[model samples]
Target: MRYLLPLLFLVALFAMLMLRGYVHNEILADHRIRPDASTDTVPERILDGGPVIDARGTGKPTSLDIPKHKLVLTFDDGPDPTWTPKVLDQLKKYHAHGVFFVTGANAARYPDLIKRMVDEGHEVGLHTFNHPDLSYQSHARIDWELAQNQLALEGAAGIRTSLFRPPYSSFADAIDDKNWPVIKYVGSRGYITALDSTDSEDWQRPGIKTIVKNATPKHGKGAIVLMHDSGGDRSQTVAALDTFLPELQGKGYTFVNLTEALNAPSAHTPVTGMDLWKGKAFVFAVQVSEHTTDVLVGGLAVIGVLVFARFGLMLILSFLHARKVRARGFRWGPEVIEPVSVIVPAYNERECIANTVRSLMASDHPIEVLVVDDGSTDGTADIVEAMWLPNVRVIRQPNGGKPSALNNGIRHARYDIVVMMDGDTVFEPSTVRELVQPFGDPKVGAVAGNAKVGNRDSLIGAWQHIEYVMGFNLDRRMYDVLGCMPTIPGAVGAFRRTALERVGGISEDTLAEDTDVTMAMHRDGWRVVYAENARAWTEAPESVQQLWSQRYRWSYGTMQAIWKHRRAVFERGPSGRFGRVGLPLVSLFMVLAPLLAPLIDVFLLYGLVFGPTQKTVVAWLGVLVIQLVCAAYAFRLDRERLTHLVSLPLQQVLYRQLMYVVLLQSWITALTGGRLRWQKLRRTGAVEAPGGIPTQRGSKENIDRRPVA
Candidate 1:
C-alpha cells in the first residue's frame, strides 16, 4: 500500500510537470518598446523604473504610450562560436546591439568572441552560470552561479552588469519562499536591477520573421528586449537583428545597455523621477574548519624544527643545489647581442650591497651597473661609492621606494635593455648574460632569473632552500606550461625600456612593484620570460621576526597590486588586452587558492596531529610519500641539496601557517586602510658559516658587447 502511494505521487508529479511545460511554452510573450522609436505609438508600456530608454531632452515624455513602429528584435540563449559570429556580422551590417542573457559555461568557452561584442560597443549582460530555476537552488549555489558568471563575462562585455532577468522571468517570482532567497542573494551580490521589459520568446521554435514581428509592437518606451543567441541554431535571430536595428535607427532611435538606460539618472533628479538599481555584493566562503585540531598539532611540529638543527640542513641543501647548477656545466651556448644595463635598487642594505656590486662587477657581459640608493641611511650608498669602479654608479634619491627608483633609473639608462635586481642578491658570473639573451624576440617584454638563498644557515634558509628548489621554480614552470609566467621573481628580473614606457612606467600604487610591473607589461601586450639557467642568490629572513616583516609586506603588497590594476585585467586597450583578460583570473587564484587549498592541509593534519590511531597513522605515512616526491621534484627544479628532504614536514607546517597568518593580516590591514610600511629586517644575521659560490662555477666569463634589445 505504501509503495503504491509513492508510485501514484511520482506519476502525478510527472503528469503535472508535462502539463505545465506545455502551457508555459504556449503563452504569448509581452512586447517591449525601444528608445529609437517614431513618436507615433505612445499610450502603453512605459512600465516601472523611470524614463524608459533615457529619453531625457530627446523631448520624449515619461509614463507614455507604446509606439507602433518600434521594434525590439532580440536573440536569446547564445552565443555559439559559429552562429554567434554570423549573428554579429548581421548586426554589424545594421549598426545595432541587443541584450544577450548568456549561459555562464558557454561564455567561458568563447571568451574572445564575447570580447568582440563589447569591443564593438554592444551590451552583454548576465543570464546566470547556467539556466537554472533560482527557487530550486540553495543559497550557496545561487551566489556561486552569479559570481562565476560575473568574473568570466563582465570582462568580455566591458560593461558592469545590472539587468538580471530570470530564465522564465516569473519562474522564481511565482515560487515564493523557495525562489526568493536566491533572488535576495543575487540582490545582495549587486544585481538589484531587474528587467521590467521582456521581448522575444525565441527559446520557442518560430519563424525568424515571426520572432521579429511578435516583438515589434506599434510603440512603447524603455522596454528591455530579451533574445537568445545560443539555445539552438540562431541563424534566424541573427538575421532579424540585421534587418531591425537599422530600421529602428532610421526611425530616430538608439540602443543602449539595459542597466545604463534604467539606473543612470542624473544625481539631481528626485527618487521618483529616477530609477536606481540596487543589489548586494556576493561572498563565497569555502568552509574547512571541521579539522581544526590537526592544524594545531602539525603547526607545533613545524615550530619545533625551527628551534633546532635547521641551519646545518640548509647549508647541505644549498651546497647540493649549487652542485646541480655546476653539473649543468655552464650552458655555454650563443652570445647575447645586447649589452644590458643592470639596475640594483638598494634601500638600506649595508652588509650585502658591497658583495652584490662586486659579483656584478665580475660578470663578463657588457653591462652598466646603477645602484639606486632609495635614501639609504645605513651607509649602503657609501659602500657603493667607496667601490668607485668606473662602471658602478650610485644615484641617490629620496626614499620614494623601489618603483620610484626604477622609474628614475629608466630615464637615466642609456641602454634599451634594462635588468632590475634587488640589492640583497648576488648574481652568478654569466647570470646576467643568461637572463638577457632571451630577448631576441621583439615581443619579449621581461625575463625572470631563478633566485636561490645566499644565506642557508637557519630554518628560514632551509625553508627558502626547499621553496627555491620546489615551489618557486616548479610553480613558474607550470605557469609557463599554462602559457603565463606569473610574477618575475623580484630579486632579479629584466625588462625592455620600450615596453615599460608603453605602460606608463611602474606605478607606486603597489607594494610588490615587480608583480605589478610584470602584469602591466602583459597588459601592454608584451611577453614575460623565465630563464631557469640564470640564477641569483638572495638572503632569506634568518629569524621569525625578520621572516614576518618581509612576508607581511609581500602579502599586503600583492593584494594592493592585484587591486590597483584589477580593472586592466579584462578591458582592452593598446596595452590592456592581456592584462584585461589575465589580471582578474590571476587575482581569483590568489584569493581562492589559499582558502580552498586547506583541505589538503586538513588531510595532512589529520595524520600528523592524531596519528596514534590506525587511520591517522596511515595518513601520516601518505604524507611522508608525498613529501619525498616533492623533495626530489623541488631539487630537480632548482638544484638544491638533499638535506631539505628531512626538514620537509617542519617546512610544510610552518609554510601553511605563514600563508594563513599573512592572509589574515592582509585582510585586516586592507579593512583598516593602513599604509604598508618598509620595516627593515636583520639582513646579515645568519648564524656563522663558510660561504662561497655553490661550486667553483664562479668564473668571470665576460662577453663585451653593445646593448641591443
Candidate 2:
C-alpha cells in the first residue's frame, strides 16, 4: 500500500500534466503551413473538380457543383469566442445558414459556440485539431485528427461531423501530389472533402468591399465561398458578410449550407450510448486538467517566491552569523574548563565502537567516556570491555531504543555537563572542548556540532556530504541567527545536566530524539545554538537502500516532533517565540519546500519535451546556479574542498528524487497512523580518531591488543 499510493499519485500528476500540455497547444503544435510544390500524383479530374468532392466512390472521384444562384458559405478555424458569435449573429440576422469548420482545440474550449451553430440551423464540420497542415502528417496522424475533431463535436452538440476541410486548404485546382493523398485518405475515412471555390482572403484582413467582391461568384454561378470567423481580426469578414448577404440576395442569389448546395442529406449524425459518454468524459477530463494546472501554476509561483526568499534570507543572515562569530572579541562567555561526561549509545555497532570510544578519550577537555551497550549481539560490549582503558566504563542494558539508552547514560553520568554522540562517530581532538564551550553561558541548554560524512569518496556518500554542508549546516547557521535552531546532530552535541533533567531527558515518542529534545530545551526557555568548529566525522550510508531507510526515519521523526510541539505556537513566553518562528521555519524549509521542490524538474521535463526548450533550459540552469552559489558559500564557510560538488547536478537529478520519495513515504506513514521502528545501518568504521588508536578493520595488532576478560 505504501508503494502503491505514491505510484498512483505520480501517474495522476503526469496525466494531468500531459492533458494541460495538449490543451495549451504545446504538444504537437502546428508551426508551419506547407506550400504547394508537386502535382505528379494528382489526376486532372480532381484538379478541375467542383468544391464538393466525393472521392469515397469506388470509381474516379466525383465532384458536384452547386445549382445556379445557390451559394455555400463556409468559415474555417472557428468556434472562436470573440468573432464566432458575431458571425453567428450576422448569419441569424440574415436568416442564412453556413458551414462552420471548427478546430478540435478551439471547439473543446468553447463548446457553447458549436452548440449555438447547431441550434441555429447551421452546419458544423471538422477543420482538424490544432489547425495542422495534413499534407505533412502521417496517415495515423490524419485519422487521429479526424477522430478527435469528431469527439469534440459529439461532446459539444451530441452530433458527429462528416464534412471535413484540411487546414490551409484552397480551391480544388490547387490540389497537388502532396495533398491529394491526404484528401483520399480522409475520404476513405468517410468524410466529404469540402474545398473552396472562391477565396475571400478575409484572414488577410483586406477591405470589407474587397472581401465582398472576392466572395461573390462570377457570372451568377453557384460556388462554395470560403471565409473565416476566427484565426485573426474578422470584423472585415463580418462587415463583408453583412453587405454581401443582402447584395447577393438582391441579385437573386441564395446563401445555403454545404449539404443543401450539394443536394445531399445532413452531414451531421446524432451520437448516443457509450460514444456520447466517452466524448463528455474526455471534455470533462480536459476541463479538470486545465483548472488543476492553473492551481498548480499558482502554487509554483508561490513556491518559487518562498524558495528565493529562503535563499536570500540564508545568504544575508549567514553572512551576519559569520561576522558575529568571527569577530575578534566574540566569545560564548569565559572558556568552559569544567570536566564533562560523554555518552556513547551503541546497538550492534561492533564495527565502529572502538574508534568511537578512543575518539572521546582523545578529546582535549577532561572527560569520562560511558559506552551504553544496548544489548548488542555482535559482542560490541565485549570489544569495548576488552580494551580495559581507564576513565572509560562499559554499561550493559537490554535492547532499548536510542532514547532509552541515552536516558540511562544520563542517569549514570557524574558531571554537570554531558556530551552525546553515536557509536559510529569519531570526534576531533578539540571537538569536546569546542562543543562544551557554549555551556559557559548559564542559559545555554544544548550546542549542536557540525557533522561531516567520513565515507564521502563513494557516490552516495558524496551526495550526502553535499547535503550536510549545503542544506543542513547552512540552515543551522541561519537558524542560529534567528535563535530557533531546531535539531542538534546526534553524531556530536553537548548539553547541561540540569537542562536535560528539566526537559525530562530524551523522549522516546519520536524517531528523531535529537530534534525532539532540542525543541524541548527551547520550550523550557533554554538556548540551543550551533558550534561550527565542533566537527564530528561519521560514516554515511554507502548504498541507496541504507540511505533511504536512514532518511525515511529522520523525515518521519522530524514530522512527529513538529506535531508533538504544535501547541507551543499558541503558548506564551519563549515557547511562543520558538513556536511562531521555529515551527514555521522548519515546516517551510524542511517539509513543504522539499515536497514542492520537484515541481521545478517536472516543468523542466515538460518544456524540454513539448516546447520552448531554450527558455526551459535557461530557467532550470538559473535555479541550479543559485543553488551552486549557495553551496559554494557553505563549503567555503566549512573550509572543505569543493571538488565533491561536481556531483551536485546529478545529485539533484537522481539523489534528490530518492530523498523526495522517502520523504513522501514518511508523510504517508505519518498521516495513515502507521508506525515505524528504528532501522540500524551496517557500519564499516571508516572514520578514526587522529593519533589515538588504530581502529582499522581486521588489524591483527589491534585485535591482539584486546585482553581476555
Candidate 3:
C-alpha cells in the first residue's frame, strides 16, 4: 500500500518533523491560539458561551423540587416602546413574572421600557444589537452586533443581561475548522436557544386567542413558553400574555425568570445561585454551508481519491472480504458458540487479573482465557497460575508492556478468533456473546465493544460517561450505517486469527495497537463494527492529573500509529475501498482535528476581544446569552440520550482543552523521537460483582455447516 511504505519510514522522519517545532506557538504569539492552559488573562478570552450577564451568584442553587407545574413566560425580541409597556401592565395585572429578551437596538431606543422590564419584575436579556442575520456575520461582526446592542440594553435599563438570544437563531453561518472555537465565545453569551417552546407569530397579526394559544405551553413542567412582545406589531403578543397568564396561573403554574424556575428549589421559590450557568458551545463549521449528506459523502470522495494502497495483496484481501459480506446471508442462532482466545496482558494486575479472567469466563461464548503475565513484580503470574482455572491458562514473561505481552499471547493463542480486553474493566455476561455475534459473517474482521463508565457518580466519570455514550456511541452507529467504522477502540476489541496473522500480528511500533489493528483489518478487507449493546464497564480518570497522563499516552500512541501507517496514505486496491475510503479517514481524525482546532479558536477570539468594540463589556454579552441556551440544550440532549453524551459546551471548556494539551505533548514527543514511558494508572475503585458462570466448550461435531461471510 502507498500508505504502508511511508509509515514504516515514519519513525525515521521524526527528526525532520521535530525540527519543524512541536508547538504552533506562533498562533499564540499572534494571539489566535489559546491553549486553555495558563491562568494568565492574556488578550485572549474563551467564549463564555452566553451574554455576560449579572449572574452575581449561581451554582447548583436549590431547584423547585415541588410537584407543582412551573412555567416560564419568555418574550423574545422586545423592550419595545410601542408594545412592551402594555405587556408589562398585563404581567402586573396577574402579578406574574416573565423574562423579556430585548433587542439591543430597541433597548437603546427605549430605556424606560428596559427599566420597566426590571421595575415590573420582568428580567431583561438581549435579542442581539440589531437582529441581523446572525449566521451570515463573521465572529467579529457577531461580536460587534452583540456589543453595540449590549450598550443600548444596559444604558436604557440599569440591567445587564446575563443571557442572550441570537437575532435569528442561526447556529453557525460557517462550518469550517476555523469557526469551531467561536462556538465557545458565542455560547458564553447566554443559557439556551430562543426559548421558543411556544410560537406566537404575533408579528404576523394573528388573532388574540390564536396568538395566546401559539404562545402558551399545553400545561407542563419546565416549559419556557415563547412569545413576542416586540420585533413587529406585538399588540397581539401583549394581549396574549395577559390572556394566558391568569388562566395558566389559575391552573397552578407560576412564572419566573429564565435564571430562576429551573434553578429554583421550590414552587415559586427562585433558583438563587446566579453563577450556575456555564454554557460552552463546541461549534463545528466549514466555510460554506452544506447539507449533512453532502458533508459525509464529501469525506468519502475526498479520501478515496486521495489515497492508494501500500501493499497490493492487502488491498486485494479487502476487496474480497467486502465482496464476501455483500454476498452473505449470515443467520443469528439461539446462541453464539465461537471459540475465542481471550488475551489478557497483565503487569502487576494481580488484583485485577482474576476478576478480568473470571469475567471472560462468565460470558456465554466459548472462551479460553490466556493471561500473559507481563513481568509483574507483584507475583501476578503466580496468582493466575494458582487459580488453575478450568478455562484459564497463564504465560509469564518479563514485563514488556501490553503490546509485547499481547504479541506473546497471540503467538500461543489456540483459536482463530481472539478477544482482547483490559484487565481493569468488567463486563456483563452477554458482552462476549455480543462481541462475537458480528463474526457470524466470515467477512467481519473485528468488533469494538461499547465502553460505558463504571464510576459515573463521580463528576469526571459522569462527564466521560456522557461523552462515551453520546460521542463514541452515536459516531459508531453513524459510521456503521455508513459502512466505515474507523478506530476500533482499545478497551475491548474482537479480531479474526487469519487477519491478525496475515498482518504479522500486532506491531509494537505504535502504542495504540488497537487502532493499528483496526487499520490493518480495513486494509485486509474486513468490516469493523461497533456493538453498542455489547457493553464494557471501565473506570475513567477521577482527577485532572490522571486524565492528563492517560490522554498523553493515547495521543502519542495515535501519532506513532499514524507514522507507522503513513504508507497507506493514498493507495487503492482494484476495489479501491481501502485506499479511497479507509486511508482518508485516518488523515481526517489523526491530522485534521488537532491541526484545525487552534486556528478556529483564535479567529473567533479576534471578534470577541479585538473587534467586538466593547466600550462596555455588556455589548458582547447579549450574543453570549444565546451560547448559554445552546449549551443548556446540549446538556439536556445528553441527559436524555442513550449514549450518555455530555453537554458539548462543558466538554468544550473541559475535555476539548485536554485534547489540545495531548496534541502538543504528542507532537513534541514525535519530534524528539522519544520512547514513551509514562506512569501507569493504578486502579483503586471498582464495582464489586456478583459471581458469574464460566463458559463450557461444546463438541466439534456441533459446529454448524453454514458458511462464514
Would you list the rank order by TM-score, best first?
Answer: 2, 1, 3
Question: Which structure is stronger by TM-score: 1 or 3?
Answer: 1
TM-score of each predicted structure versus truth: 0.50, 0.87, 0.48
Give me the runs in candidate 1 sitting further than 4 Å from their true place: 1-335, 572-585, 588-591, 595-612, 620-624, 685-709
- Candidate 2 regions off by >4 Å? 15-32, 38-50, 59-75, 78-98, 105-122, 155-157, 197-202, 205-257, 260-264, 288-292, 693-709
Decreasing lDDT order of the candidates = 2, 1, 3
TM-score of 1: 0.50
lDDT of 1: 0.60
Model 1 lDDT tens row, 1-709: 3124434633553343332222122121122211222323332333332222223333432332223333333445556777788877877776665556665555654666767876765666566666666655667767766765665464344335554555545211132333334444565555543343445565574876777665454454434555667767766676677665766577676665443443353111111111211111110000011123235346445433332222323335444544543575443244456677888888998888877877887776888888888888988888767655546677788898788888887876879989988888888888888898768767788888888887776677787777676656655554443335668887888898898888888778778788788877776677786777788888888877677678778778888877876677557673465555455445544543443333445545434433335676575556556556756865865656687677777776667566655665666677678777766776782322123322222234222211111
Off by over 4 Å in 3: 1-336, 386-388, 574-576, 598-648, 690-709
lDDT of 3 by residue, 204-261 (tens): 8878898777656563644656677766777667767767888787877888776666
Candidate 2, lDDT over the whole model:
0.88
lDDT of each: 0.60, 0.88, 0.58
**Cα RMSD for predicted model 2:** 4.7
- Higher-lDDT candidate among 1 and 2? 2
Q: What is the lDDT of residue 154 in candidate 2?
A: 83
Query: Candidate 2, which ten residues in sequence have the lowest lDDT sum?
Result: 700-709
Tens-digit lDDT track of model 2 for 658-707? 88788889889998999999999999988877658533444444432242
